[model samples]
Target chain A: MLITNEVPDGAGHEDPGHPERPDRLIAVREGLEDLALGDELVTVGLRSATRLELLRVHQGAYLDELGAFCYEGGGDIDEDTYATYDSWPLAQLAAGAGLAVVDELARRGDGVGFVAVRPPGHHALPDRAMGFCLLNNVAVTAAALRSAGERVLVLDWDVHHGNGTQSIFWNDPDVLYVSCHQWPLFPGSGVPSEIGGLAALDRIVNLPLPAGATGDVVARAFEEVAGPVIDEFAPTWVLVSAGFDGHRDDPMADFALSSGDFAHLATWAAGLAPAPGRLAVFLEGGYDLAALRHSVRATLSAVLGDPSANEAPTNGGPGSDQIGRTLRERASTLTLVTAQRDAEEAS
Target chain B: MSIYPRTIAVGFDGSPDAVSACAWAMATGRRLEAHLVLVHARGLLDRFDRRDPRALFGDVVSELATRHAFNEARLSWHVADGDACSVLLRCAEAPVFADLVVVGSRGRDEHAGMLIGSTSLQLAERSAIPVVIVPSTTSEYHEP
Candidate 1:
């Protein structure tokens, strides 16, 4: 399932072009239209989350503040985050799209769902908006699942740590949050040691990479740390806070991931079968138009098990083998990650 | 091989964008018969030992230079301590003449604009010379 809302008419400004503009989604939609991927493509309408859903992970005061901030007529919320009048409603739509995707997948028995809404969510905290995010959509969804008595595994690969997602679930053992991001950038969190709360220690697995870390490093991190952890956790559902900022061409973060890497990661995630009806992805961030579009198609193709369906080759040749070597070195660290099932069984 | 003998300053931060920028710089320097300066800025090292930073920077410089076949004499590596954008600006202000300033763009988020990371933006906005914002996704070399 692909969920999206029509780009709000006349919502953008005259600022020097930023990556999180309407063009990003237009490029992605154009790419999908070009793919001719057949019946696999399912478009769904964007919806607004109810008040109860918003309260799932955010404080009431924060929501009230956000509403007030939007009502004041939109301005820079921070160095990176923007809040325009439409941002509030659009953010709700994005978060709601995330919840609806998860719910639909959960209700349909077994399938992969993708929410292609904008105003990417991973950077939003429980009470504040940062990094261009107004809502922690993935966290909200995870909170929803936890409330519904389901265990969730959140895999975030945005080139920057999903700090909000990590912080929201830090103390909750029911949610397993894994992030692969370039460290020492932006919000400047996600050190290897920021594991989680005492009870949920190790539930949050963070693989921080030096800048210039490439697709190979990402793949290895997944194969080694992320994949093994998810396998052990055996989640009732899998949620992906999919961010394309890691794309090699992306101007956002320094990690060197290719479209193929995104596809490979998606395929790897889809392999971990969630209980009966629970696997979904919510878009987070991706800036460059070509890279974002190609990466999104590749990710969806990977989830659907048909990468070749897209057909057009992305610019540039395959990446260096050094990326592969980096993955191997990083994956070796997983030897220390305790298996979740094994620990539970022993207990 | 002494054609123009220009100085090419390449910013290094151990990021893919930086590495690719360095690679592009080395190739450009070689093509232009210019000297290559691999400027590796020492970021906040409060948690890490100072010696570790020196060793790490030295290793990266040596490894990248040797792997790319740029002459040690033609390649000069310097490590400075400060904010990445500030350090880059300082380097640009130095007396050394540079034909081009090469840096990598981390891209833009809703928070940050089109120039991508702040460093790229700073260089683009403040550099005295032409700035090359190599996208992280770029696989091939771009001509100046």
Candidate 2:
């Protein structure tokens, strides 16, 4: 299911030469169309989230303040965040699209759901907008599912950790949040010890890699930490906070994950299931236009279980082995910590 | 007396650049016997929110404060709302007084270029105080 909105126009006005501009979505759509993915795609549009829906993951006062700022005409929401007339509504639409995708997938019984909305949401928190995100769409959707009696697992593979999502679910055992991001980077808060919510500490898993980590490092992280957690959780549903900013070509982050890595990860995720229709995905962050297109297409193809998805690019020699080893070590460390926590909880 | 002011106000928002600026401020604040004021603009938070930005900022400040032998009294933390440029400008223009301001070369989403970011450029353009921009790749901030 393709979930999108009139975000292209909204994003167009944010920053003219910015990397997170509307053209990124346009390029992805054009690429998918060129590849005829549209033939197999089912498109859907979403209305702006109601105040109640937003309040699930964000503070009402914060939402009010954001609206106030947006209504005031021009101001920066935070460092690296901007607001215009369209930003508030567009942010709501962006978040609403993610929820709409979850609802469609939950109702449809079978399909891959992708929300091509912008101004990414992973960095947003319960009360404020940061990292260009006004709302924590994935977190809100997961909360919605939990409220509806569905156990959820949120996997964030953005180059940067979904600190906001982790923060939101830190103490809740009902939702499992796992993220593999470049460490010593932005927000600098995803330490392994920062397991979530009181007494539910093991629910949050953070695998932080050193700078210059490559695709192999990320894949190994999935193989060692992320995949194992999902296998053990057996959650009722799985939600991916998909961010392609880890692409080797992406300028905003230093991780060197290739398009092939994204495809592999998506395909791997698609195979896990507590039910026939349990997995959903929402976009987060990716800057490089070419990498974003290729990565999204690769991920979509994997989600669709297409065997002929494009092969991993071979632009350079195999990535740094040392970094991969370091990432492996970090994941192992987190896995041990999580296991200990789980054991303690069981006792 | 020294030509450069001793007290430095650094702007941090948890980005790589922001972290670097914080590290720089810690070091510079120590060398000059000046105070380090880490100013971060808190985003809008509703009552239902659980995470505490002040606690997070305090963790970083306490870590640096202990390591540098700087008294907790000498460190100040401010959490405001709005743009980074405007916040920094306000601190620089405040009666509290600052000799210099430090920021990361590039923000979280900004690309590499001659100018760090629009906010940084604006801060440089508007501030009477000198500004320091540390590159994201720089090793100054990596040590624990």
Candidate 3:
């Protein structure tokens, strides 16, 4: 099943020469159209996320300031991020799209939910905007689910570290955060050594890959490393910080992945869900319009086990060594983390 | 037990207020006999572009050397690829482990009316260390 946004495109939020503009949503729609599901496709739109829902992930003071800033005519939040008169409302709508997908999937009890919304959210922190994200959409859904007592695994394969998502769930034992992105890149936080907080040691599995790393390396990291931790955690729900920027064609960061790689990744994520209805994907980033279109088609199609256009997963690239490196780091970090937890327990 | 500011993280982005902050940081670093870490966050746009992002760092250091006769050993600069606030915050962690953070009230591309830039506000709100938002008019405080 496919879930879409109720709000209009981010026209008011556009900045000339900016990469994260309004046309991204159009590309996503085109990918969906190519599927040709006809009656089989379930197109759903959700209401704007409530103030209470937003407050769960964002600071009240920040919400007030951001809303005021936008209404008063927004400008660049940083060197890259921008906002405008319609941004606050559009952000609320984008966040709501995720909640809407989760709500509908829970009600149906059987379909893989995908929400394609702009103002892509993984990079947004609880109190501030970073990268191009204004608010944490995936976090809002994950938080709401956590409140209802669900164990969540936030699978972020965005090519850039989802620093905001990782920061929000760092100390929470219930949410397992996994990220696979290019190392030494923007907002550089994810490293093999950043195991979760003291209370939630090993809760985070950070797999930082080198440039030109192929889809085969990514799959190995997921299935071999994150796979076991996920199984042990036994998450009741899975929320993907799905970004197509990793495709070789995108200019954002270096990771030589293809549409076929995304399909395989989606299939792996689909199997992690405790139930078919417990999985959902939220858009984050993808700069190249054509790559975004193809990657989206392959990913959404894979989730439903449907036939769609795809490319061969690339291989024989760098970063194969990263998997072993991650394991060694995890083993060493666990020693220190376990001690920290033990010391706290004693106190 | 906490020196609080034995090491100061100063943000510079080639803006007017950024210069003011750096001047203030130089004098402050000299007075307290502290180490000053000049941090510049290279955003995604900068990362994609091939231009050198740290050109301004040398100019500022030259100015400091002329005025304060600043000891180069007491200062260092870093260009981490990220947003302004995040790079400084990360520098405060393992290697640098800065005890204090500082930034200008506004940055290069901020609106003219904004009293404080997003970088300064975010640093003030998020930094684990104490933050000092140096205004553009921060008189180059020398040993007085």
Candidate 4:
């Protein structure tokens, strides 16, 4: 089930001509339409998150402040992020979509869920909104599961690093956060050296790619770097910060990934999950209309285990090889994880 | 003078439709000055399961109740260890009594009913108290 808020359909806005406009949802819907997914795709309207649920990820004061900000008719969180009259309630609905999807997946153990909500959440801090985001949806979901004594793996594939998510889970042992993002992008903080806090070195993983990195590198990063780490972690629940701005056509970033690459990445991640139903993807960022649309379709296909999903092969770039080497070197320090993976695979 | 029932009891299973029924019941309870009782059937699932069913579904129930809590009606919840329909019926016949018992036209099972779930169907048939089965198609009963 796709849990979504109708907010993207003109309920709110960032600016008049902003890239993260309401039409993005329409573009995504058009993409879903193009794929001819009848019963394969089911959609449920979002339930607004309760104040208590929001408190799971955000401080009480922050919630009160954001609520006041929105209720007072909207303002700017930063130069980039905006809030309107509809923004606060819509953000609540966006955060609620995460909870709904997790609830559905955990209970039914069936259909794959995608939360196509906005304002996009990966960049939002627990206290302040950033990069057109209000609340960190993926982070909120992870916190909910972790609080429930479930180990959660958050895989963020946005072009820009999921600094907000990483910050929230930086020292938490139960939640392992991994990101593959362009280094010199907005909210620039995902450096390779920033593994995590003192206790969480093995829990946080970042693959900071340079400009012009291809999907080939991303695929290799997951297979050689992210995959082995996930095997060792053995998380009970998997949450995806499914961002498509890495696509070559996106104006927001400079990565050369295609839609096939995004699908390929999702397939690999899905395989790493204990079960297909354990995986939930949340839309993060994808600015280019065609790129966002096709990438979303490809991701849905991959998550659904579609036999005919596209797999556009990479041309083999130096960008991927360098990242592979860096990760391989980092893997040496993660001896416990490496040994655990070996034992699990051998069994 | 409100024409609605004084005590409304709702059957909740965390399905979209069930959540919607809770919303509808709350609205009606507010109008009629009723006390709302939400009954969840844990006996429907396997008893051997390690986790507490209430703990697993507590967040959802809390969200549902909290949304309608500030209204005129008094909201309370109960976890029953029996079939949903049977438990709801028993609540209706209790001394405190439910004037109107509300339930979703369907439960969580996606394909169980053409329009109504077995619990709702049985409740509609056997319950002596007035029963209001909210259809999944009602736009007004969106999840709270």
* Winner by lDDT: 3
Taking all chains together, each candidate's TM-score versus the true structure is 0.64, 0.69, 0.89, 0.65
TM-score of candidate 4 restricted to chain B? 0.77
lDDT of 3 by residue, A129-204 (tens): 7788988999999999999999999999999999999888888999999999998888788998888988788899
**lDDT of model number 4:** 0.73
Give the distance in Å from residue A267's predicted Cα in candidate 4 to where it truly belongs: 0.8
Worst 10 residues of 4 chain A by lDDT: A1-10
Ranking by TM-score: 3, 2, 4, 1
Q: Chain A TM-score for each candidate, in the given order?
A: 0.85, 0.88, 0.97, 0.90
Residue-wise lDDT of candidate 4 within B1-144, one digit each (tens)? Answer: 455677788887677778788888876676567888777654312221333646766677666556766353376666554446556877776543777889987766423322212568778888988888898886447434
Per-candidate interface DockQ score: 0.03, 0.05, 0.51, 0.01
Candidate 1, residue B6: how far the Cα is off, in Å: 44
Q: Can you give the lDDT of residue B37 in candidate 2?
A: 78
lDDT of 4 by residue, A1-347 (tens): 43333334544655676677787877777767767776666666668888888887777867777777677776544335568878888888888888887787777777677888877898776665666778898888889889899999999999888878988888788888999987655565676656666567678888877778887787777667667778888998888999888888887767888888887888887876787578888888888888888888888777777723344745464476567566765666566555666788799
Q: B1-144, model 3: which lDDT tens digit per residue?
A: 656478888887777777778778888877788888888888877766644645746876777756875677888777787777778877678778888887888887776554334677767877887889887655444445
What is residue A132's positional error in candidate 4, in angstroms? 1.2
| Model 2 C-alpha lDDT per residue in residues A1-347, reported as the tens digit of each score | 44333334565337654456777787677546644654567776667777888887777777877777667664554445666877888888877877777777778777777777777888887766667777888887899898898878888899877878987888787898988887655655676666665556557777777667766666666666666666777788888989988887887767767888888888777787566557877788887888888888888777777733455633332334533554465567667777777899899
* Candidate 4 CAPRI grade: incorrect
Better candidate by DockQ, 3 or 4: 3
Off by over 4 Å in 4: A1-10, A307-311, A328-347, B1-144
How many clashing residue pairs, candidate 2? Answer: 4
Candidate 1, residue A81: Cα displacement in angstroms equals: 1.1
**For model 1, what TM-score is found for chain B?**
0.73
lDDT by residue (A1-347, candidate 1, tens digit) is 44333333324421234446777777777666766756655555667887799887777877887777677766655335667777778778777877776766656665677777777788777766766678888887889989989888999988778888987898898999988787655556665566677567668887777777766666676677566667787888888889888776777666777788788788878877555446787778888788888888888777777764333322332333433444454444333334554577689
Which portions of model 2 show Cα errors greater than 4 Å?
A: A1-8, A307-347, B1-144
